[model samples]
Target: MKFAHDVIRKPVITERSMEGIADNKYVFEVAPNAGKIEIKKAVEEIFGVKVAKVNTIKLPGKWKRMGVYRGKRPDIKKAVVTLTADSKKIEIFENMM
Candidate 1:
């Protein structure tokens, strides 16, 4: 079993993600192999909040090239977690807004 920290890599702090806070939705970068259930559990365990829904998006890696060499960025998996109506807001994001 993966630890909550392992399942949830980090919070996504872009402008688009920040806008979700007002709707009780938060974005996170999750392990590529993690599923919706795992993400939901991880967020609930780490934040102590009830999760209403979970949506995931997988972005393919992009290829890049240097003068002589070529490489690709690692693929990313993101999860959008929506909290239950009565759940308290996540404090980490509260300070940012």
Candidate 2:
């Protein structure tokens, strides 16, 4: 697999994701075309951490209503990377005032 920089774009920050990260797991909104192996490689390389496990989920697009037309949200892929106990940390929020 290619290095993480070419696979994962960036980490996703949100309420739920922050909660997970606080528990020692990090979440990211990965490219829809990326898979588990790709995600694993990306996280390890980009974060400089030891990836113990990788989990992926594909979220279906949501339907939206319009007066005379309808639209759907784009599908997205999510990855949860679990790091080794002694791996380096990713401090998402250092100083936000």
Candidate 3:
């Protein structure tokens, strides 16, 4: 079994993600098959934050139809993790020049 910090990718940057961060939470798009424990571990290892709680959401594939073709958007798994009150801030956005 994987610890709660090995399957996280990076902090996702979106309007919704920014909103979450403003509320003291961080958002990430995780491996589709990863569980909560793995996600938590990955976040900790990558960001060096103490995870206080983890919430996951599995988005269903969306249908798409076109002329002579039909397919669906890929599904995605997302996680929202809250950090401990005393944990340092994670600088996901840095100056890159």
Q: How much lDDT does candidate 2 score?
A: 0.77
Q: Write the per-residue lDDT of candidate 3 for residues 1-97, one digit (tens) a residue.
A: 6544447655678777776665568888888899887777787787787999999999999999998899999998889888888887777643210
Each prediction's total of clashing residue pairs, residues at least 3 apart in sequence or on different chains, is 0, 1, 6
Tell me how far the alpha carbon of residue 68 in candidate 1 is from the true structure, in angstroms, after superposition. Answer: 1.7
Which 10 residues in a row give candidate 3 its minimum summed lDDT?
88-97
Ranking by lDDT: 1, 3, 2
Evaluated with TM-score, which candidate comes out highest?
Answer: 1
Question: How accurate locally, in lDDT, is each candidate?
Answer: 0.96, 0.77, 0.77
Model 3 spans > 4 angstroms off: 1-6, 93-97
Q: On lDDT, who's better, 1 or 3?
A: 1
TM-score of each: 0.97, 0.81, 0.82
For residues 1-97, what per-residue lDDT tens digits would candidate 1 score against the true structure? 8999999999999999999998999999999999999999999999999999999999999999998899999999999999999999999999998
The TM-score between candidate 1 and the true structure equals 0.97
